[model samples]
Target chain A: MATSSLLLLLADGRFPAGAHAHSGGLEAAVAAGRVTDLVTLEAFLAGRLATAGLVGAAFAAAAHRAVTSAGSAVRGSTLALLDAELDARTAAPALRTVSRRQGRALLRAGRAIWPEASFDDLPSTPGGAHQPLVLGLLCAAAGLSRAETAAVAAHGTVTGAASAAVRLLGLDPYQVQALLVGLASRCDGTAAEAARAADEPPERLPAAAAPLADIHAEAHATWEVRLFAS
Target chain B: MRAYARLVARADGRGGTVLAELRGETPLLLRQTPGSGRAVTVYVVGGAAGPLAGDDLRLEIDVGPGAAVRVHTVAASVALPGRPDVVSRMAVRAVVHDGGALHWLPEQLVAAAGCAHLAESRVELAAGARLTWRDEVICGRYGEAPGGAVVHTRVDYDGRPLLRQSLAVGPGAPGWAGPAVLGGAPATGSLLVVDPSIPHETAAVEGTLARLPLAGGPATLWTATAADAHTLRDHLDVEVEPLLTKVE
Candidate 1:
């Protein structure tokens, strides 16, 4: 399969990876009045792209490197460490649970579509392996490169949240699409940076954090009623 | 140009005591608190005109097994752009051995307007060790716009990464006051607690507004922002000191 087509498939918001249920904390931001308008939404997306987006991309790229690189015997430990590292980078308990749920969902899709042995090596966490780790495994099954995995990770990170913003805030879809178009270059740059660091040790991966987003995720978890899982 | 301080704590049957101490310009003063023989409190005092341009301050702290150490600063250390030729920097490294504990609560770091300062702190903890650390930063003096300040902190527990953060706040920083970043707050305070004994999701948040789970082991990083540095520091202390002192 062509790499771009496979990337397009996985990067699609409707991939059935269960990403639809999550607003990527956008619901919480909207509820908090921080994302009331288009300009603020843009700021939220830009910040998310830099922090969570970059971290997810780096880990996904690193996991892809682990699976694609030589030494098949160490793949198990490498993937396990990647899962734990991603868990550590995620600061919100609710986000951790959401990531694992999303990871399990993606794994179900991967097992059905790819049926690769690399996915079998990923140990199940109390929640599940982080979404990025599972995404990396699925990418390896599709014969995608590390950079492609990073792209998938980075793009999915913002697109899910952007789509969530549309549903929550009822913004103009065309404008949101245009904003995403403007962010395309940033997505490419972030993926490249993540792929470049893919060879680094798992512990040395980038740890970009959004403190407010984390706090919001925690608050979102306790809500009696909400639109997003995280 | 370079100031250094080292503090080594040893378990003395009942509690921990400062075993070896060394200092250059920024000295560490050891104080004894009531009812705790093993617990020692350290105060970082500045010499002369505080931290100036081109000055580098280094602090190394170690807590032995079964020992406890608490550290605080005398007063706010102003980072002045005396020469304007170089940036003032402070680097701190700390370690807690198995079953040891350390509580490091420092006063506000006032980065005066137009000055540039960089502060980095790294902490390592053994499997059974515990640490409660707090840091407060005032971007600039009261009623003034922020200068330039960057704080980078990393914590590792049992050789596993716990938390790592780089906060750059000042003019020209992208969205520094936006809701995604500091949310228009002038001062920011952070509390990092890494301890297994503490129950998960156990945090009492008051005054300040933000709390998040830490990455490594059983830890939580609580952050609060307020109109001024004093209020921010109060928020950090209110939520964190109880947890740290309970280790005794």
Candidate 2:
């Protein structure tokens, strides 16, 4: 399979990764009136992309590097450390559950698409593997490069939230697409930066944090009726 | 100026806890008194002024087995710039032994205008050790913009990585007032509790984060805003007591 086709397949919103159930904290932001218009929605997407997106891409790229750099034998310990590192980066319990839930779904899909030894060695987390960690392992199984893994990581981080914004707030789709188009260049740049750090140790991975998002996730978890799971 | 403070709380062998060692400066004050259920409450008072530029302040605290220590600050610690192109730093290291608990609820640390400050804290805990820690930061004085401040926090329980995060804001920092970041809030507070034995749903929702399950164990993290240090302290007092009492 061509690399571009593989990237499209993974990045597709309909990848059956269980990402649909999560609003990526957009539901909370909407309820709080933080994202009322197209401009606020753009700011939310960009901020999330820059912080959580970059961090996720870095970890995913590192996980992919861990498999490809080792030439065939997947090190369980390295994968385990990567899992722990991602866990450290995430501060909200609700967000971690969302990540693990999506990760389990992705792993289920990956095992069906490409059953490989690297995927077999994924460390067992309490909830499950983080979504990005599992995505990286799937990329390794698909023979995708580190940069592609990061692009997938960064692109998915904000795009899913943008889609959620549309459903939650009934925002104009054309305007949201424009916002996404405007952010495409920066998204690529973030992915490049994350891919460059793929060779760094697990502890050295990017730890960009969004404090408000973590707080919103916490509040959203307590809501009796929320549109998205996260 | 370089200053240091070390506090060690040990079991008095009489069904109570006592301060083993206490040493510091005016910038870091300590007053120990008997508290509820084998715990000693220590009130930390700041001096007339906080650490100036070029001042290195280091604080170390340890809790022995079967001991409980609770530390509270009287007022907020404001970091003032000493000289041009210089930064002030506050380093705190704490440890809790097995079957012990340490709760340090300090007031906000305000970064004065034009001042650069770095506040770093590392907490290491043994198995069965419980900790309820809270820290907050204010951008600057009221009616003023934020300065340069970076808060780095790391925690380990039973030799496992729990949480390691660095929050940077102000000029030239990423996500200054963005919606997904601080949402234009001037003050931010974080409360972390490291104890897995307690039931996860026990944390009452008072402020930002009610119950956040950290990776190392069942920890509660609340990062939100307040009007000032006093208001933030009041918000934390109501939320923190419920979580702190659950350690035993």
RMSD of 2: 3.4
lDDT of 2 by residue, B1-248 (tens): 77788899998998788888987886776777656777888888775476677778889999999888888888878888787787788899999999888988887788888778888888998988988888888888988877787788878778777787777767745455678877777777777777767666532344443445676666766666666766666666776787666553
lDDT of 1 by residue, A35-101 (tens): 8877887778877877788889998898888888847799888888888777767766677788889
Model 1 spans > 4 angstroms off: B14-16, B26-37, B48-55, B77-88, B110-117, B143-148, B170-173, B202-215, B244-248
The CAPRI class of candidate 1 is acceptable
Give the RMSD in angstroms, all C-alphas superposed, for model 1. Answer: 3.0
TM per prediction:
0.89, 0.86
- What stretches of model 2 exceed 4 Å from their correct place? A1-5, A70-74, A196-204, A222-226, B18-20, B25-55, B81-87, B195-197, B202-209, B242-248
For every candidate, give the share of true A-B contacts it also has: 0.36, 0.53
Candidate lDDT scores, in order, read 0.79, 0.80
lDDT of 1: 0.79
